[model samples]
Structures are given as structure tokens and as C-alpha cells.
Target: MKIAIIGCGNMGLAFARAFLKFDLVKKEDFLLVEKGEDRMEKLSSFQPGVITGVIGPQIGTYDLIILSVKPQDFPSVQEALRAVITPNQVVLSIMAGVTIANIQTVLDHKAVIRAMPNTPAMLGMGITAYTASPEVDMTQLRKVENLINATGRSVFLEEEEQLNAVTALSGSGPAYFFYVVKAMIEAGKKMGFEESVAALLVKQTMLGSFHLINTADKSLDELIKAVASKGGTTEAALKQFEAGNLDETLIGGILAAQMRSKELSKG
Candidate 1:
């Protein structure tokens, strides 16, 4: 089936590359709708057979149209799509905060899907959470699932509103990890390691720690206990974290992210 990706930005090109990797769509069958000449030219070189241009009547030939534009660009994009959408098409959106209902109000397509794909998708190892309108057929749902899974994992949230929490968690979760890693690197450097050494150490610590969690059946608290032997270095750090209410501080930050997610819906 032919797939058209609107707004050929990072997420768009990443999705395109993943789809191409899995042979879900060939270069010729894909159309990239982008506004800038430079970006269009760049994507053309990446996949020569794919077509790139502003959305128009000629581009309405796609069976599935994926929206990858930013939220603020939606109004003008809606105007552009109003006349071009046909019932023969399905719409998949990766734009945050803009709901499936909002998309329907603009593009007027019954088969709409909204997905939350995070930053790590650039490396094809991100996680995406998505849900679709009831109008979407099983085949279309599977196709979209495959598309989201092309990069990494996919979670199907039964209730559409759960996307707000998904956005709060996974969507913003990477930045949180980066914040911790940055602090760890700085701490290492302050302790006498060079910048490069600190980075290597912190990166592997974060990576290895997560890998252990993924492999182990132990609870996080149990894992902490395992690392913190009676009066060891890990215990000292844990004591400091407890004294500073680190867990409560973390919860507050996550709650702030959730609130921001809801706030974006108002925009």
C-alpha cells in the first residue's frame, strides 16, 4: 500500500527509514510532503524513488496519510488537507497533544490513529504508544502497528486519554534520564576523572543498570538493597538520597510533566 508522510522532519524520515528497512513500503510507493526545498532535496538523496512536495490534489493518491507536522502547524495543514482527503484514505498522526478527534475535525477522515513516538526513534529503538478510532479496520490497525513497531516497541492503549500519561512518561522520560546522566558525569569529573572518562563510565553505568533491570526479576528496591551492602559506598549515596527526599522530588517532576501534557491540549 502507498503511504504519504507529511512534514518530512526527523520523526518523518526516521519512520520512512524504518519502514524501508522492513520492506513495508518501497521507495517508489512512499511520498514525502515537505515545505523546504533543501529538506526535499536532502530526502530525495536518501531515497531517490520517493516523491516530495507540498500536499495537493496530485498527492491525494495515497492510501494512508501520516501526519508528522508540529502541533502549531496543524491549522494551516488542516486547510491544505481539507479538500484533498478522500474516504479511501486513512490518517495516522504523530503530532503530540492533537487528538484523533481534532484530526477528524480538520481532515474529516473516519479512520484516524494517534501515536506517541519518542526521541530514541532516531536510533530505531524508541517506544511508541498508539490508539485508533473505532472506524479503523483490523488490517489498517495492524499496518499502523507495524509502522510504529518498525522503530521499536508499540503499546496499544485502550483509552485514548492515556496518551497524556504516555507523553508524560516515555515522551519526556528520555530527557529525565539524560538529566541524571549529565549529573553523574559531572559528579565523576569532580571526583577526578576526565570528561571523556566520566562520560564513558556514566554511559555504561546507565546502560548496564537498565540492562540488569530488564534481565532480573527482582524489584527495584530489592535491587537497591543488593547494591547497598550494610555500610558501603552505595549505602552512603542511598542515605543521602533518602535524606534529600529524592523519590518525592522525582515524583514532583513527573507530575509537572503530566500537567504540561494536559496544558498542551488547550493550545
Candidate 2:
């Protein structure tokens, strides 16, 4: 299938690389539209059969198109694509906040899909949340899912509105994980370790904890209880966390993120 990527930014390049890595689409079937000369040079070095030129060439005559441009540039993108994309072509938008209905309005009622993917997609470990309208059939939806699944795992949302929650969770989730790692590292240092030692400990601890969570059949609270024996150091830390209402704080943070996502989409 012919595929075109409009932005060639990090996410776009990531998807392109995953596509090439899996041999899902032939090199000749892909076209990249990038304005940055240096970045374009980088893409050329990858030896993918990517035509770096006007969006018009790439937008027209493509079976599938990935819209990865910045949200602010979408007006010009819509204007550029109005006469080019046929009803048969599908538009998969990876922009954070844009909705499928808004995209279809721009493309004159063409098939449109919205997807939210995070930074880990560059490493093929991201989870993408996508939704499609009635314009897409089950077969077409699976085709899109297959392409997205190349980058990482994917989930379909029945209600398009839940994309906001997806944005708050997986979309911004990587940074949250990193933030936790940072806090762990800092706490380690405060407890009298060298910076490098603390970093390594935190990293390995996180990895091990992740493996334990995956392998263990116990619920998270039960696992925590297992570690926090009565009146032990772990129990003391848990008490502190409970005193500070960490759960409430986390819920507030996620809600804030969801609100910001809604604001971006409205913009």
C-alpha cells in the first residue's frame, strides 16, 4: 500500500522506520514531506525511498496518509490537501489534539482516523490510542491498526471523547514514569549514595519492580502490603505517602493533564 507522511518529525520518522523495519510497505511506496533541510538530509541518509518535495505530490495518489504536522500548521495543511486527497485515501492523524471530525471537515468528508502515541514509539515500545468514525469499515480499520501496530501495540476507543484520557495516560505517561525514576534517584542520593550509584540503583530497581509486577499474580496493593511489613521501614514510608495523600495528588495531576489535552484540541 502507498503511504505518505507529512511532517517527518520525530514521530513521523519513527513510524517510517518501523514500517521499513517490518517491511510492511515497500520503500518505493513511501513519500516524506519535510521542510527542514538538515532533517531532510538525515532522512535521505536512511536510504528509504522517500521523495522529499511538496506535500501536493505526497498528498495526492496515496492509499494512506499520516498527518504528523504540528497542530498549529494544520490550517495550511488542510488548504493544501483539499483538492488532493480522494475519498478512497485514508488519513491517519498523529497530532496530539486534533479530532477525526475536524480532520474530515477539512478533507471534505473523507475517511479520517485520530491516534495518540507517545515518545517511546521511537523505540517501538509505545502504546497508541486510536479511534475512527463510521466512514471506516472494519477491514479498513484493521488495515490502519496493522500499520499503527508496527510502531507498537494499539487499542481502539469506542468513544472518541476518551482520546483526552488517552492523552493524559499513555500520551503523557512516559514523562510520568521518568519523573518517578528521577524522584527515586534523588531519594537514593539523599540516602547517601554517589550520583552514579544512585542512578544505576534507581534504573535497575525500576526494571526489577516492573518484572515483578508483570510476573506476580498479586494485585498492586497486595504486593505493596507484602513489602510493607508491620512497623517496618517500608511501612513507615507508606505511612508518609498516605499522609501526603499521594493518590489524590496523582489523580489531580492526571485530571490536569486531561484538561490541558481538551484545551489543546479546542485550539
Candidate 3:
């Protein structure tokens, strides 16, 4: 399919790289519209697609157009996009908190899909949740889903509102994972391990645990019980965590993020 990407930033480029890597779209069939001189120059090194500095009538020719611009930058590009966007063409947006209704209204076009993909998409290991307007047909939706899956995996939500929860859970999930890793590393340092050594230990443990979670035919509770043996070191740490209400705190923080996402969507 012919695809056009409006922004070439990290997430945008991540999609571009994944599409190319999976042979989903040929370099010739891809078009990149980026305004920054340095970014445009940098894009040349990768040569992912036909690069241009401005949105033009030619954009209407593509089968699918991806809007990956910042939420604040939508107004700057909307007018230009509206002028050339065709009704039959599908527009997929990855901008955080930008609703499908808003995109369809602003662009004066239908068949819009909005998706939330995290930073891990840059490494082709992300999980994305997406939703589409009623105007988007089954074929178009599936095609978009296939494209999104190139980054890792994707789930389609029936209601756009669910995306706010997804934003809090998986969208901001990597940072939470990093936060825990950092705390563990700090605790190791306090226990007399060097910073690098601590990082190595914690990272490897996390990695192995992740693989176990995926491969082992065990529930999360079962896995936890296996590690936190009765009155063991892991159990002691888990007890401290429970005393601190860490699980509740984490849930509260994610809920706060979801609330903020809703507020942004309203604007």
C-alpha cells in the first residue's frame, strides 16, 4: 500500500523502519513529509522513502496517511492536510490524546484510526492499542492493524475511550518499568555492589523473569509464589512492598495518567 507519514520524529521513524524491515511497504511507495532541515537531512541517510518538506496535493494520492505530529502542532498542519485529504483515503493518527472525532472534523475527512504505541515501538517490541471511526471499513481497519503489528503487536478497541486507560497502562508503562529498575539498582548499591554491577544484575534478572513469564505455563500469582518462598528474602521484600502500599500507589499513578489523558482529549 502507498503510505505517507507527516512527521519523521522517533515514533514516526519507528513506524517507517518497521514497515521497511517487514517489507510491508516499499521505499518507493513511502512518502515522508518533515519540515525540519536537520531531520530531513538525517532521514536521507536512511532513505526510507520519498522525502518532502511540505504537505501538498500529491499527498492525496497515497492510500494511507499517517499523522504523527505533536498534539500542539495539529493546527499548523490541519489546514494543509484538509485541502488534499480524500474521503476514500484512510488517515491513521498516532498523536497522543488526539481523538478520532477531532481528526475527522479537523481534516474534513472520514476513515480515521487513532492508535497509542509506546517507545518500545522504536525497537520493534512495542504493544499498541487502536480504534477506528465507523466509516473505516473492515478491510481498511485490518490493513492498518497489520501495519501496526509490524512494530510488535496491536489490539483493536471497540470504544475510543478505552484508549485513555491504555495510555496509562502500556503507553507510559516503560517509564514505570525503568523506575523500578532504577530503585533496584540503587538498593543494590546500598548493599555494596558497584553501580554497573547492580545494573547488570537487575537488568538480567528482569530479562530472565520476562522470558519466564512468557514461556512458563504459570499464572502471575503462581510465579510470584514460586519466587517469594515462605519467609524468604523475596517474601521479605514483598512484605516491605506491601507495607509501603506500592501496588496501590502504582495503580493510583496510572489512574492519574488516565485522567490527564481524558482532559487532553477534551482539548
Candidate 4:
């Protein structure tokens, strides 16, 4: 199938690379659109035969269009696409707050799939949550799912509003993990390890912890209890976290992200 990707930014490039890596789309059948000349050059270097440019009359030739442009840039992209996008072409958007209805209104197209994916998609480990307009059938939805799954896992939502919660959780979740890892590395350094060694220690600890969580059948609270024996060092740290209300603060932050996501969609 002919596929066109607009923006060609980090997320776009990640998807492009994944598509090429998985042999999901031929290089000749792929189109990359980016306004920046430098980005076009980079894409050309990365995938030699893919076509790159702003949206034009030729856009109608593609069966699928993946919109990866920033939400702020949608107006300009929409205007450029107004004359070219046809009802038959499907649009799968990964812009954080751009809803399928918003895309439909802006581009005057019906088949739209809106998705939220995180930075981990660059490593093919991201989880994308998506919802589609009624105009998209199950066959088209499955195709979009396969394309998205090239980067990582994908889930479908019955209610579009749930995307706001997904945006708060997995969409911005990587940064939360990184924030804690940064603190852990600093704590290691304060305990007398070198900077590089501290980073290594914290990184491996995180990886091992994730592995344990994935492989074990125990619930998260049970796993925590397994490590935090009464009156032990783990318990001591747990007390500190509880005293600081860390859980409440984290939940509040995620809710704030969801609120911001809703506001962005409105804009």
C-alpha cells in the first residue's frame, strides 16, 4: 500500500525507520513530507528512495497518510492538504492532542485514526493508544494497527476521551521514569560512586526491576512488600516516600497532564 508521512520529525522518522526495518512498506511506495530542507536531507540519507516534500496534488495518490506534525503546525498542514486529500485516503495521526474529529474538521476527510505514542517508540518499545472515527472500518483499523505495531504495541479505545488519560500515562510516562532514574543516579553518586558508575548502577537496577515486574505473577503491591521487609532499609525508604506524599504528587502530575491534553485538543 502507498503510505505518506507528513512532518518527518523525530517520531515520524522513528516510524519510518521501523516501517523500513519490518519491510511493511517499500521505500519507493513511501512518501516523506517535511518543510525543512535539512530534515529532507536527513530523511533521504536514511531512506534513499522515499519521496519527500510539502503536501501537494500528488498526496491524493497515497492510500494512507500518517500525520506526525506538531499540533501547533496542523493549521498550515491542513491548509496545504485541503485541496489534495481525498475521502478515500485514511489518516493516522500521532500528534498528542489532535482528535479524529478535529482532523476531520480541519482536513475535511472522514477516515481518521488518532494515536498517542511516547519517545520509547524510537526504540520500538513504545505503547500507542488509539481511537478511530466511524468512517474507518475494521480492515482499515487493522492495517493502521499493524503499521503502528511496527514501532511497538497498540491498543484501541471505544471512547475517544480515554486518550487524554492515555496521554497522561504512557504518553508522558517515560519522562517520569527518567526523572526518578536521574534522582537515583544522583543518590548513587552521593554514596561515593563515580558519575558513570552511578548511571550504570541505576540503569541496570531499573532494567532488572522491569524484568521482575514483567515475569512475576505477583501484583505490584505484593512485589513491593516482598522487597520492603518490616524495619528494613527498603521500609525506611518507603517511609520517606510516604512522608513526602510521592504517590499523591505523581498522581496529581498525571492528572495535570490529562487536563493539559484536553486543553490542547480544544485549541
Candidate 5:
């Protein structure tokens, strides 16, 4: 199928690379649009066979259009393609806070799908949560799933409202993990290890813990209990975290993100 991707920025490039890697779409069948000359040059050098151009009349010919532009840039993009987008074409958007209704209103098209994808997509290890407009058919939805799954995994939501929560959780979740790892590395350094060594230790520990959680049959709580024995160091740290209300604070922060996402959708 012919697919066109607008905005060849980091996330856009990630999707392109993932799609190409999985053979979901052929390079020759894909169109990469970027306004910046330098970026267009870079994309062309990376995939010479792929069609590259600035946004123009040619976008109307594609069966699918993937909107990867920034949320703030949507208005201009909408205006540019509003006259060309047909109801038969499916529009898949990855811009955070740009709701399905917003796209339909702005672009005057109903077959839209809004998705929340994380930075892990860059490595083809991300999870995406998506919801589609009622006008989208099952075949189009399945195609979107296949394209998104090439990045890693994808889930469909019946209600579009859940996308705000997904945006808060997985969409911004990578930064949360990195923040904790930063603290761990700092703690290790304070305990007398060199910076590089502390980083290595913390990174490996985090990776190993993630692997264990994924492969182990036990629930998360069970694994936590296994690690934190009564009166042990892990228990001591857990107690400190509980006393400081760390979990509550983290949840509050995520909710705040969700609220911000909702507010942005209004714009």
C-alpha cells in the first residue's frame, strides 16, 4: 500500500525505520515529507529509493497518510492538506494531544486514528496505544495495527478518552524510568563508585530487573516481596520510599500530565 509520512523528524524517522525493517512497507512505496532542506537531504541520503519532498499536492495520492508533525504544527499542516484529504484515505496521527475530533475538524476528514507512542519506538521496542474515529473501518484499523506493531506492540482502546491516560503513562513513562536510574547512579557515586562504573552498574541492574519481571511467573508484588526480605536493605529502602509517599507522588505527577494532555487537545 502507498503510505506518506509528513514531518521527517526524530519520531517520524523512527517510524520509517521500523516500517522498513519489518518490511511492512516498501521504500519505493513510501513518501517522506520534510520542510527543512537539510533534513530532506539527510533522509534522502539514508534511503535514496524512498520518495522525499516538502509537503505538496502529491500527498493526496496516497492511500494512507501518517501525520508525525508536532502538535503545535498541526494547524499549518491541516491547512496545507485540507483541500486534498479524501474521506476514503485513512489518517494515522502520532502527535501527542492532537485528538481524533481535532483532526477531523481541522482536516475535514473522518477516518482518523490517534496513537500514543513512546521514545522506545526508536529502537523498535515501544508500545503504542491507539483509538480510532467511528468512521474507520476494520480493514483500515488492522493496517494501522500492523504498521504500529512493527515498532513493537500496540493496543486498541474502545474509548478515545483513555488516550489521555495512555499519553501520561507509556508516552511519558520512559522519562520516569530514566529519572529513577539517574537517582540510582547518583546514589552509587555517593557510595564511592566512579561515575562511569556507577552508571554501568545501575544500567545493568535496571535491564536485568526488567528481564526478570518479564520472564518470571510471579506477579510484581510477589517479586517485590522476594527482593525485600523482612528487615533487609531492600526492605529498608522500601520503607523509606513508603514513608516519603513516593508512589503517591509519582501517581500525582502522572495525573498532572494527563490533565495537561487534555488541555492541549482543546487548542
Candidate 6:
């Protein structure tokens, strides 16, 4: 499929690299529109696609167009995009807080798909949640799904509103995981381990725990029970977490993120 990506930032390049790595789109068939001179120079470092400084009528020829610019930059992009975009072409937007309905309305076009993807997509281990307008047919949906899967895994939501929940949960999830890991490492350092040693220990433990979560037949509660034997050290940590309402705090923070996402979407 002929694909055009309007921005060449990290997330955009992540998708571009994945598509090229998987042979999903040829370098010749791919087009990159980036306005930054330095970014354009950097784009030349790797042969991802045909690079251009601006969007033009040539954009109309592509089967799919990916909008990866910042939410605030869409107005300028929309004016140019709307003029040349054909009705049959599909637009996939990865810009945060930008809704599919708004894209369709702004461009006076249909068949728009909006997706929320995390930073892990750079490593091809990301999870993306997407929603599409009714005008996107089954074939186009499947094609877009296949392209998204190249970055990792993807889920299609029937309601676009759910993307905000996804944005809160998975899109911003890595930072939460990192925060917990940092705390664990700090605790290890207080107990006498060097910073590097503490980091290695905590990182390995987290990695192993993740593998167990995937491979073990036990439920999360059961797994916690297995580690926190009655009156053990794990039980002490669990008690402290409960006392501080850590779980509730984490949930509240995610809800706040969703609320803010909703607020941004309205603007």
C-alpha cells in the first residue's frame, strides 16, 4: 500500500521503521513530509521513504495518510490536507486528543481512524487502541490493523470515547511502571546495595515477574499470595501499600489522566 506520514518525529519514525522492517511498504511507495530542516537531514541518514518539506497535491495519490503532528499543529495541517485528500483515501491519525469525528469534520472527509499508541512502539512492543468512523470499510480496517500490528499489538474499540481510557491506561502506563521500579531501586539502595546493583536486581526481578505473569497459570491475587507468605516480608510491604492507599492513588491518577484527555479532546 502507498503510505504517507506527515511527521517524522519519534512516534512517526517508529511506525515508519516498523513498516519498513516488516516489508509492509516499500521505500519507494512510502512518503515522509517533515518541515524541520534538521529532521529532514536526519531523515536522509536512513532510507525510510521519499522525503518532502511540505504536503502538496502529491498527498492525494497515497492510499493511506498518517497524521502524526502535535494536536496544536493540526489546524495548519488540515488546511493543506483537506484540499487534496480524496474520499476513498484513509487517514490514520496518531495525534493525541484528536478525535476521528473532528478529523472528518475538519477535512470534510470520511474513513478516518484515530489511534493511541505508547512509547514502547519504538521497540515494536507497544499496544495501540484505535477507533474508526463508519465510513471505513472492513477491508480498510483490516489493512490498518495489519499495519498497526507491525508495531506490536492493537485493539479496535467500537466507541471512540474509550480511546481516552486507553490513553490513560496503556499510553501513559510506562511512566507508572518506571516510577514503581525507581522506588524499589531506592529501597534497595537504602538497604546497602550500590545504585547499579540495586537497579540490576530490581530490573531482573521485574522482568522475571512479568514472565511469570504471562506463563504462570495463577491469577494475580494467587501470584501475590504465593510471594507474600503469611507474616513474610512481602506481606509487610503489602500492608504498607494498603495503609498508604497506593492502589487507590494509582487508580485516581489514571482517572485524572482520562479526565484531562477528555478536556483536551474538546478543545
TM-score of each: 0.94, 0.93, 0.94, 0.96, 0.94, 0.95
Model 4 lDDT tens row, 99-216: 8888898888999999999888988998999999999999999988998998899898999999999999999999999999999999999999999999999999899999999999
lDDT of 1 by residue, 1-267 (tens): 889999878888888888888888877788888887888888878763466577788657888899998888878688778788888788999888888887887777788998999888877899999999999998989988988888999999898888988988898888999999999999999999999999999999889999989999999988889899998999999899999999899889988887877776767
- The per-model lDDT (C-alpha) reads 0.86, 0.86, 0.94, 0.90, 0.89, 0.93
Clashes of each: 0, 0, 0, 0, 0, 0
Best by TM-score: 4
> lDDT tens string, model 6, 1-267?
999999888889899999999999999999999998999899889979899998899999999999998888889798889889998999999988888888999999989999999889988899999989989999999999999999999998999999999999999898899999999999999999999999999999999999999999999999999999899999999999999999999999999999988987997
Candidate closer to the true structure by TM-score (higher is better), 4 or 5: 4
- Ranked by TM-score, the better of candidates 3 and 5 is 3
List RMSD in Å for every model shown.
Answer: 1.7, 1.7, 1.5, 1.3, 1.7, 1.5
Off by over 4 Å in 4: none
lDDT of 3 by residue, 1-267 (tens): 999999989888999999999999988899999998999999999889899999999999999999998888888899999999988999999888889989988899989999999989988999999999999999999999999999998998999999999999999999999999999999999999999999999999999999999999999999999888797899899999999999999999999999989988998
lDDT (0-100) at residue 259 of candidate 2? 92
Give the range where candidate 1 is weakest over 10 consecutive residues by summed lDDT.
46-55
Q: Weakest 10 consecutive residues, lDDT, candidate 2?
A: 50-59
Ten-residue stretch with the least lDDT total in model 6: 94-103
Q: Give a tens-digit lDDT track for model 2, residues 1-267.
A: 889998888888999999989998998888888877888898999877776757674467888888898888788677778877788888899887788878887779568889999888888888999999888888888988998988889999998889999999899898989998999889999999999999999899888989989999999998899898998999898889899998889889989999988888887
* Worst-scoring 10-residue span by lDDT in model 4: 45-54
